[model samples]
Target chain A: MRNILLTISYLGTRYHGFQVQKNAVTVAQTLQDAMEILLGRREDIKGCSRTDAGVHAGFYCLNFKTENPMPLPRIQRGLNGLLPWDISVRGCREVPEDFHARYDVLGKRYRYLIWNSPARSPFWEGRAYSYYPPLDLEKARAVCRAYVGSHDFSAFCSVKSDVEDRVRTVTHCGIEREGDLVTFTVEGDGFLYHMVRIMVGTMFWVNEGRLSVEEIPAIIASRDRGRAGKTAPACGLYLDRVFYDLEGLRWEEGKDLG
Target chain B: MADLENIEHLRKKRARIGFLKKALALLLIVAAIALAVAFRHEISRLNLVEQLTSHLVGIGSGPGWPVDISGITVREMAPMGNDLAVLTDTDLIFYSAQGREIRRVQHGCANPVMKVGGTRVLLYDTGSREIRVESKTRTVGSKTMEYAVDTGDISANNCVVLVTQGARYASEVTVLDKNLAQLYQWRSADSRVMVAALSDQQDEMAVGTVNVRDGQLYSTLLLFRFDEEQEYVREELAGELIHSLRYKQGCLQALSSRRLLTFSETGKRMAEYSLGEETLTAFDSGAELFTTLLVGDYREFKELDLAIVDYTGAAVGGSQLDFQVEDSTAAGDRVVLQSGGTLYLYGGGALLDEMAPLMEILDIQLVGKNLYLLTPSTLEKITVR
Candidate 1:
């Protein structure tokens, strides 16, 4: 038996979400159906993290062990042909057995896009957050920097999360703008549900001069969801990359990839 | 030319001042009306929040509860949200959760015992053989048994009834169906039946029996069919006194003086929960996600600490109120502990609210979702949102 790990991408605008839900058309459900059709049986697969509806993903990894004698390129072509255009199988590779997609994760990267131009763009609709007012770029940059390092991010997470521990470490967070598009890159050890969207909303609040730079640390210290900024729209979020420590994780055959 | 320009400037300034004064007067009138309307709405909204929140925290008014207690000896009171039932010495009064007395039944009682489940009520008269199942504004069923009941409980559907009677060593039990039809009867000549729990489905019963053998008290739990003595399971023990037996959801719980035990309907022991101290009195159970209230002394000071035990038999949290609590009942997702003159509200095993300075709380009953306080004079219905 060989464990096949696949990296996939999807335009989440038309899909419900990444998880398999009851009576809902989700990215996971569609991919699972395509796999069942290609393999003529069910394959046990799980995504690294769940994405909310209308949130796109540029990179995601899933692994499932199968005893099929088919080759990697053939399995990938078959599965992709069965899947919808919105979801595409980017690449598939043979990984060692016992490789999990979620638990062995080292870190993750997410990007949020914003259109600061006054004119409404039909193309960027469902792709970027549009704000006509002028934003103080330096103030936004300061709060983004404040989010770096280890801290409790309870205020940035959605209250629906029942997790007891909300402490996370952000290694990198930066904001840059070229023309009308302002891109935000955040790399963290872990992210809670809607953490990035709330952080983005808070950045704009700083730019709009509603919240101050000094209050960011106190908000993180409060550990209360009500003290945080509003959750930005799901359309502007994109899962960029997932980092894994292949050498540290247990796998058969003693082979590793970093 | 300079004098003409000055006259023109003064004329324009005067016109602007006149407009500004009129505009300011109109704005003041509009603001006053808006504030009056908002003030009225805020008062009612606060009233509604107090009536519905069920948090039982800092309440400013008794908008959806009883504000007065006219002098009357309330025999038994059952409060469940909007359906409130109060049994006086001579009449059974039904009231809404909002303190509105709806109906009064022409039923009298000598020593009455009432059990409120969901919205159904079971009232038994110890002096007589009368057992009546009632709800708000209506009598579901009534029966006159051959033996007077020491205590009784009807099923949630008002279909099955388990009534037990005992004096010294001889105790008897009767199981009845919805039409007051006798399904099972048992007489114990060598033991005293302390408590009996009838399943809500009316298919089985669990009885706690105590008998003195060799001058030692021995307790036995017997599970059997409602009508037949063909026992499904039976177990015996020698320890604390059995306080009560209750059938809630799908499990039959035996509440003892020291430990709490849950058993399946088929008589297999599921779990045993020991509170580490002797239970003071009968602990309340029978909620879906039940929070059992244990009032026992955890310190040498003899002060009672109210412990909230979740359904898993684990004490999640508790209040250190040290009040001499009489009884505590689970209402919705909250626990209402009633002592002499105070009511302690606990949610998620933590004390969320408390009401004190109350006039002698005799008993507290939760029906549906409302809490009914049976004081010396009135049956007060309170909702802890």
Candidate 2:
């Protein structure tokens, strides 16, 4: 059997998200069905991660095993052609039988957009939240900086999230603005559900003069979701990319010599 | 000769066995590496889910280095540019193409207000009656000679149009140059001007007046000469209760509560159509497109539609955009909309695309592009390409 990795992108607006559900349409179910049709067999496919409903992915990864020996390019093309317009496969590569897409991911990055305007936008009607009130970018930045380093981010996550470990490392966080648009970009080893949104919500308090940037340490120490800003809407957030170690995939002299 | 042949055969057999062993070893190594990779990915995924759940449950610090700002609000977001301009409601803050702070203008305004015009930054202070024009190389500031009027608003043409209604009770539309100098002021025969809009060229102004006896608002799109006398030469359109009006290119677009109307600059009615049952929530006009957003019922939040109108007052394309409120508590969160080549969506107080439960979209803005969205945030700096 051959294992293959697939890189994909999809619009998350309609489906239940990236994972498959028993009765709901999902990106995974759709891709699995398409693959089943192309391969003429029921193949169990796995996704890199499960994105919640309304969550979008720019670069997502998945893998499936098959006994067929078709070329990698054909698999990528055939699956893309059969999938819906909103879902697209960018590339595919054959891997050793043991390789897995979700299990091999090293880290992920996400971005959040804020439209701070006084008038509601007709174009961005369903895409962004209209924050009419003013914000303090400096305070937001300071709070963002506090999110860096390895810590238990229990304070910034949503309730009802069932995970074993709360500890994660945030590699980077920053706030930026142009004209009337502000954005927050964060990268980390991993994230909690609604972590980015709640962090943003807490930062809003600082930006809006309600919370102090210095208080972030206390908030982190508390590990309370109620202390953070409202969980931001789902539309404005995007999974930007995922990273993996590139040791054996590409030519390495040490491995080659060994 | 027989002994030599036997030795050669033995050597060949040994060589073949060695090659096979090497191949098997290589295969094992590859398998191990693949397994390791797969294991790492699985562990990370589990760790991520656990970390996410724990964080959501308020146990650990979330992802990234925590950044603390006074406050952060997405002021304006452009999907095509993947860039957002945010303001802290204080001074001028400019972000680079890579989401970095490039420049900031301190003490730029006591109360900074911005009107977007084809990538131009027309900033004004109602309190000080001051105007500042910002571009790439030059930052110019000017003050109006007259006192700041109560009902003054800037037009797409960068003209400040005002209607003063106290004491004198006279209707006036003053055309100001970029320097805030009174180029000309056109006074109406009657004193009750209801609404006004400036032509895209800044050469003309349209005014609406209410006829009390008929209990209806009568609007006339007037042509004015800014250079010479500033006199109204002709009346463009007379309509009842002009609810909204916008001037783009050479055409004057107006909307009553019940119908959509278009007029030419030469005082001629171009076209008129009924708006039907959908209540117009917002309207915007660009050089190439006129957009209108309509909402049905709040409880049902029933039908949300975006109608794109051409210059000739014809509906070229229309589509229904859906938004879910989830429940009653999700109400009151402002939905932000923006348009350039395509429409962008945001709700729940954060910019869209950050937590997109849908597809990944890049938000971008070109230098000198005019982006219009509704928020209460102050306007930051405008980047000139």
Candidate 3:
């Protein structure tokens, strides 16, 4: 059996989240089911991260051992055929036996979409969140700039979440607005549960004039969830991409890809 | 003399002790005051009385819901029991009551649209020319269209109707089953096929066409059946553009922008009503009743009105909304009109209640007995009264 790496995209609207839990359905389980049906055997899938439910992903990574020597084209088409319409496997490749989808990760990018229009479209029904009140875009951006660089994101994550360390390096966290669509993109080495959502929710509070941008340092120092804004909806959050040192996003018709 | 000497010695000792004690007390007091000033912020943090009072001043509660999933690019939603079928740009997701996705399928479709028909779902991708028929969690069957289909709809009885047009001259109509297999096909040889409607049983179909007679354009509706191979009824609608050809509640409704004409299933003219000469923006329907939002200039008058019209082409009741509605959805016995951040829920054509203002609401949908509010960040569920 050969270990394989797959790039994936999914609409999180119907998922319990990216990770599998008891009783609840997940994206990973769905992919595993499709893999089993395609290869006619069970394949243990290891996902890069445990994205919460309703969080979309433009690019995510996972690995599985496939005894079936299905070619790249066949695997892509076959798994896609067996999979549901909401989840898609973009590409697949054979990686080194020791290559891991999670451990060797260099960074990951996440994005959240905000519909700033007062009027919402039925087309955007489940896709983007609508923010009606006029927000201070300039100040909201300033708050985003403050999050750039490495820091302890203790207060930015779920208080109930117990991680050994809350220290994460945020290489980029910025906000951009095009018409009424507001996008928040962040690049980091790792994230805590609900960290991105809380960052966004708190940024909104800053824009709403409820919280000051200067209070962010104290909130981080406080390491308290109460100091941050509301956790933004999972619908607006998306796993944008995962980066490895060399593999990046290239998985062409090559002999080996990791 | 010895007593006097002892008294003097005692006085000297007492004076020296007093001076030393005073200096020590002053130094200690100064040190204590310096420490308090230096750690004032830290001391304030320990003030439990202030902390409780500050908690009281804090607004309601904060948002930290451990929500599982969020929705996106939702093209359409079909509420099923405690679940919802959401059609995104390229996929179909079936979500449980708690917003957990039970199943998902990637259609790789372009310009996708989904409709819930009876117990089956019809997912069509106009760009890919593909139609996938899904029942619950499984895709039962799928087929590809030869041409890019424009207007298509499915019935609860598992009938699919599609209108494909290459140009104004090249047009065709096809009817299919839940498997997306073509059961009936018709290509317009003389007139351009504008729109088509399928019956609930998948046994009957209606096609609307536009043909020229003596240089005058004429609109017509024809009834057909596969076994009969005959045009049961060919009703000519003069000068009226049949915008929508739908069979609702045992009647054929051919509605244009300004008029609605009803016909019997057997192709007999029943009744007709002239809507105000205005642009009909949106039309929402229930099991038996339908209403249209007419904006822009209405005849000579200009305002927004919700005209409730029945299948017999008669106006049930017309009410002018008090506010400019951004969007609205009506289902069962409830009609919700959203203006800005507030929602006005109406029952029996009268205002019932108003939802509190939200930060931003993109859309509001009535699912079963619950209210689904689409915000900028989440889809919140609220109980219906």
Best-to-worst order by TM-score is: 1, 3, 2
Given candidate 1, what's the lDDT at residue B95? Answer: 64
Error of 1 at A69 (Å): 86
- Which parts of model 1 are misplaced by more than 4 Å? A1-258, B1-69, B117-119, B162-169, B277-282, B298-300, B310-316, B319-321, B338-342, B357-363, B366-369, B373-385
Report per-candidate TM-score of chain A alone: 0.93, 0.89, 0.93
TM-score for each predicted model, relative to the true structure: 0.46, 0.39, 0.46
Tens digits of per-residue lDDT, candidate 2, B165-271, equal 43454665666655556766866656466666676566776666555445534554455556656444444333345655667667777776556777777747788
Tell me which of candidates 1 and 2 scores higher on TM-score: 1
lDDT of each: 0.73, 0.60, 0.72
lDDT value, residue B130 of candidate 2: 52
DockQ of each: 0.01, 0.01, 0.01
What is the lDDT for B13 in model 3? 100
Each predicted model: what fraction of the native A–B Cα contacts (within 8 Å) does it retain?
0.00, 0.00, 0.00
State the weakest 10-residue window (summed lDDT) of model 1 chain B: B53-62
Candidate 3 lDDT, B4-58, residue by residue in tens: 9999999999999999999999999999889978887665434333333323323
Look at candidate 1 and tell me the lDDT of residue A163: 83
